[model samples]
Target chain A: MSIPRWAWVPFGVALALLAVPILGLLVRAPWTRLPELLTSERALDALGLSLASCVVSTLLVLIIGTPTALVLARSTGRWTGWVRTLVTVPMVLPPVVAGLALLTTLGRRGLLGQHLSVVGIEIGFTTAAVVVAQTFVALPFLVVSLEGAIRTAGGDYERAAAHLGASPTRTFLTVTMPVLAPAVASGTALAFARALGEFGATLTFAGSLQGVTRTLPLEIYLLRETDTDLALALAVVLLAVAAVIVGLSQRLRGAHG
Target chain B: MTQRLALLVAGAALILPLAACSPAPDGPTVFAASSLSGVLPGIEPEASYSFDGSSGLVDQIAGGAPADVFASADQRTMERAVSEGLIDGEPRMFATNHLVLIVAKDNPAGVTGFDASLDGVKLVVCATEVPCGAATQRLAEANGLTLMPVSEETKVADVLGKVVSGEADAGLVYATDAAGSDAVEAIDVPGAEDDPNTYWVAVVKGAAHAEAARAYVDSLVGEWGDDLQHFGFGPPL
Candidate 1:
């Protein structure tokens, strides 16, 4: 696994590019005020909201996305391409555009939202809207990751269980799911982390209120205007959380391999 | 082959900074608040513009963003820059804007100005970090009303968008912004004139085109005053 000598230069440059920003965050962080900043009411509210919404969104992603992954992995029809493309759309679309799409689809006067509002139900600028936006953006991570894992795990064990007098659902529950569990865990972790870092779409679709829709990223952004020290401290907290999630996901991936 | 690849990478590294440092050929780079995004280009079509929330612009300028001139929607933001010595000289007041309550064209919530009809309505306003938000707060206080906004958007434009989209029953945005958009109808806020936000312009401390920056600021106060008034900005008091 010896790396080419010429590649080292470009690789070194890439590593430096990634390392410098993290180093900058570490260096510029207000270490002295971090304790007070994180303990502040604003910080706590945002932190709690971020964790709750992210958890709810991740659960929603797992419940729906796992079946979607299974179907995509098994299907061979031409429409599968379209379905996969639709699933991956949020991953490529700008976060703000994803937010706008969500807004237009579920806003008070949005496509279906206009009808919903007639029934006195509105999704826009609510905590539920925050979850919807997060789920929209985070769905692809779980679906894509689990789809690849399902494809790699293949149909052998499922076929064996089916032949041994097991029902399709029973085979999936007993054999298929266990085999893909590690991948699912990693994917869920990745999706949860993505939801945790969601800012633009949530801001656009859900709007920002202290305890309602302002997640840590949105709080950090608003604070940057009024208090850079608090912003930096919160950013350090977000960075640490993201780092831990990424590490855990990587370990899950290693376990899967 | 490897040598050629290494040389190509080295050449790219050398050229990238030069590419970034290349100035806009015809005009100075102007950083103005998001509220001015609509009219600033119309007023000074030649200058390259970076439009954002004024407080965000202040942070960027402080962080060494490549800005030649800076125009803020309020005095407080400009004063912060002045206090931090980010400006080359004292910023001059160029224009003024006051908060206007905007609603969907049909006014679904039956919002008529800032009256009791606003009670229990899904109202939005700019976050207090930006200028319009500050004025909204002042207007609310001056009139002795406690506004309960459903959301506090960082950009006034977002506030307007929410109202236009009918996600919000009403929003507080700049008078000029309301005037610029046809999607929403503006309702005058009582005593808004008393809490008007003044626009301030200044050249950055080490602007690449310092003379052009100063000229732009001069024109905003001088020739562009009429244009500002036309676009719903009040003449500087």
Candidate 2:
């Protein structure tokens, strides 16, 4: 079937808007110095911290978000809508606002934080805060994606397994989980990418300390103030990582289909 | 359906040009450092302002962001802009600021003074890239103390925020920031008085509103001294 000519105008405009900046970045990136820049001590530290924290946060999203997604998908109640909205709040909030919210609730003088400080346990400005901020921003992506998948998969298979004398836990582990593996993988990838790119919230809530909370995005931002070439190089690295993850996830989904 | 589409297109065409027009009747847009957050806006209530780290502002101006005037927290950044041909003329000194050790109003950690003993204390300071952070490093060196900070924020306001929030026991911020916040109390660092952080202001090269930009700079140089003083900034050297 031939597509309408007017539709091509808007589609082309959208494609150009998205592709221009990416093409600009590619053209301006310092390809020769990329290796040296990526291996710099500060760059390595930020990359290491970003990788470690994002991994931890992705794992956290998988564990906590999976159960939450399951509940949201299976349950039917007025309160469930509110719960789902609350879970997705961070996804919609500006990262800086999310950071401020986290700070007010978890900082030393924060409501619960002040009480916790009495026991001499502090989480602000630490690596742990980085994980918390990343998880806060990334959890919604995992929950929303997985919940949609769970709803699509439905309960017929689980019901059949239960009718066959399989326990609910066993059925979930063998039947439901296997069926949802592709969704879980795609959700995990999306959450991992989101966590890796987290900047404002981590900088505001966790504070940018080398070897602790300064992730690659923060490092790129700091470098942008001083060295554009190095910043562009680091940005290319982030873009490459994101592209790889997205390509892999698409391939996985395609294979499943 | 076509009528609605035409109306929508017409509305967007009208609004797009309006958005592209210059900033409203407020005088020329001034990109000033965050340290001038309090005084710049108050002095030039009619002028538009963008306050952020001096280096970040320099980067923005260098990348061709449109601004009539640029006010930097340190001379080095202004000089850099001048060297890069981003500034119209020689940047002039406008105001100076001194570093101070600020603790939460309650002084929970009971920080006594600027000493090496602060190594054990939880402190926050601006990252070395920012003007405040660079000044902090000079002060630390002048005093011969190796300070270990729990966090190095990108901006002085963030450092002040951490201290005010009691997340950090102490922070090194401008005296002006300390003066503005009752939530934090300033502790005088002895040698900090010697290494002052001077501010610079200049008109941007090829500014769209050159007359307004020069007038804005003149206003800052002429009668804003008292305003700066009111904001806890030191007189221009």
Candidate 3:
């Protein structure tokens, strides 16, 4: 495809806008102290928590969100638009507001939480709350991406499989899922990345306790107050992890195709 | 399609510069500590405000935020600002506050006070990085008390919030903060009176609204002293 000359100007500006801040970070990052910073107990704890919680949240999102996307993609109901809008609210909401919403719904004194606590079930300020907060914000990305893919893939193959005497579940597992594998992989990657970077909601809902609730981003925020050098080093580590996730996902998509 | 693309490009061209070049606001932008969130607006409603942990505000000012005035919750933070040459002159002590133990209304946790009974309770406090947190440590040490908090929040407001929201049994926060919120009941911390946190205010070094900024600081320590008191702040030390 031949590129328009005028379009190049805006494209270059967009590239610079993204690249410059990263360059600033790289330039300011304490390269000499990175290894020491990364290996510190606090850094290791935050990194471990970020990875563990993101993995759990991504799995939870897949289990819950896949059905949601499928239902939205296949539904012909009048309320489908509204349902999808509600599902996507977290994506557009300021993460802080999303945290507040979670608190109001599930905190100890929250509407649902009040009832749950009566049975000795508590979610607030726990590791479980961190997972919940992460899953809440990450679910929309998977649902939105997979829904579009399901719509684009259509139901022709699934119908043929059903006509051939394949059960609905079997058709879904074989015909429907195989065709949507690329979308699922990309969506999972996006959800995982979003979970990894989640901060405000997690802090607001789960609270920041080292090794229990504070993820890498929250650690970076706290460290920035007391230790800027360590904070910058941890940010560079997070940037690298995000880049690797993206690169590996792109490769996985190409391989599937 | 071409017309739409042209319109988009023109729109970007028009808005980009305006976004990049933020003109000075009508009034001074007072960067204040989060402990003053409730009272600063009432004290000088004419000026704009940005409230956060004093350390965070200092970082922002150092990183080139266009703050006209800086109000800190403790002497140490204001000293750091002055030491970094972020201030125009000596910061004035405007108000003083001490630590207090706050609990959910009616003392749901049945915490008697800042004593041994607080053990095993869900206590929250400010992190040692911020002003309120530093005062919390000092007060605890002076009283020879050891506290094991469930969470160490970045802002005094967050500490107060955890108590207000019923997520925590107790939180250590400023007297002014506990006094301002009707959702919680305040209990005095022993030795808090001996180590009160002093609030300081000063104009920023290179503020765009330098004159307005100075006037605002002057009024806060002068005529607005009583207003601070009305909002639960103690008189300047």
Candidate 4:
């Protein structure tokens, strides 16, 4: 059945709001001059860095954030409320502050950094620092989304499965996790996209060295150095990459459903 | 049903126009260096502002951004802005800044002097895209050092951040800026003599608010010159 006209208005308004940015993107796409801009060195370094960091960060989130999600999902104490809030801290923190926090905790002079300095190992302003900054921000998005799914899957599913003939780990790996597949895909995709576009923290902590720490956002920023058309061109690519992730997420979610 | 529908319709009406464009109040557009923001309120230029890298401001002006006034962190950028005819007349050099090698008060690598420097220090600088970076590069090269910076930040503040955050052993930043931060302490090297920093202000061409821009430029000459110099800039024009 069709939704009522008035009810559809908010949806329409939301679409309009979203459309404005897309329209600006299209209007300023630098379409005719696309080929020359796309192949430039800054474009390549940024695109590579963006991809590498997103991949590494998504891997880290899945590795570390999943266990945290599991713990939060299973716990129902009153502290869970506060824990839930804490999980979202990075999402709200300004990217610059997040970078500062990372550096203070892990830079060469950082609390841990001073110790690592003896070993001659430094973390900040490196490619590895880029990964750390991205993971710091994106992990929360994945964790929160995954925890919600794990909660919805509920203990009952696992408990009954355990009684029937499955181990707890087996039930989690098979029935519970398979059922939560759609959420996992969606969360990972969201986290990946966020990691890809992250700028301030990366610039602050990773130290924008071309072909080293210079991610796509930095490249786009650096693009304003010589060419706004190229900057606009980079923006177009960023939009495209984001759109692809969003599309893949939807398609995979549809399949999972 | 009617109440829900009425609320939705009213909400849509209110948000639709609001999202498109709000009414704007009038103001001149002063494009300035991001460093200027640290003390913009004191000068009270009669305009709205978009503060960013000194080079970014110069680029925007050259690219025909609708800026009425331009203030930059160093002579290189302001001079270039004037050369492009993006600025109207002789830009007055009103203030000076100095570069320092800042470290976290805790100090990591125990970096001391630049003339004894090499390409290996964990240094940070403003990218050559901005004027501070340009000044930084000049200073490093002048000291007979080849800097292998860990990062090249867009703004001088970010370079300072590298030091404060302990990301780098040292960063080249404005001494006045280092004074404002608890995260960093200045290490003066003997070679800073040749790299005296300066700031220049100019009215942009095709400014819609020429009168305001002129008044602001005039302020920089004597009275305002002293204020800038008080902030550790060199002597007034």
Candidates in order, interface RMSD in Å: 4.2, 6.0, 5.3, 4.3
TM-score of chain B of each: 0.88, 0.88, 0.87, 0.77
List the candidate 1 regions with Cα displacement exceeding 4 Å: B1-20
**Candidate 4 or 2, higher lDDT:** 2
Tens digits of per-residue lDDT for model 3 on A3-59?
Answer: 666675576466556777899999999999988989999899999999999999999
Per-residue lDDT tens digits of candidate 2, residues A1-257?
97664664465445555677899999999998888988999889988999999999999999999888988998998999999999989999999999989889888888888888889878998899999999999999989988998998878989999999999779978998999999889889999999999998987888888898889998888777677888898899899999998888787677656
- lDDT value, residue A8 of candidate 2: 48
* Better-scoring candidate (lDDT), 3 or 4: 3
Per-residue lDDT of model 1, residues B48-144, tens digit only:
9999878888888998888999999888889998998899988998888888889888988899778777888999998887667778888888778
Q: Tens-digit lDDT track for model 1 on A127-177?
A: 999999999999999999999999998788889899999998898888999
lDDT per residue, candidate 2, B1-237, as tens digits? 575455445544443464366555558989998878888777888888888888888878888777899999888888889889998988888888899999888787778888865777789998887677888898888889898898888778888988887788899999999989999989999888778988889999998889999999988887645688888888888
- Residue-level error in angstroms, candidate 4, position B88: 5.7
| Fraction of the native A-B contacts that model 1 recovers | 0.47
B168 Cα displacement, candidate 1 (Å): 0.6
lDDT of 4 by residue, A1-257 (tens): 87676666686467556777788877977899998888977788788878987899999998888878988998889998898899899999999899878877787667888899779787766788889899999999989988987876667778889899998789878887778888888889989999998998888778899888989898778767657798899899989989999898878767665
TM-score of each: 0.95, 0.93, 0.92, 0.83
CA error at residue B39 for candidate 4, angstroms: 4.3
List the global CA lDDT of all models.
Answer: 0.88, 0.86, 0.88, 0.78
Kindly report the interface RMSD of candidate 2, rounded to 1 decimal: 6.0
List the candidate 3 regions with Cα displacement exceeding 4 Å.
A251-257, B1-20, B25-27
Using Cα atoms, each model's DockQ against the true complex is 0.45, 0.36, 0.36, 0.40
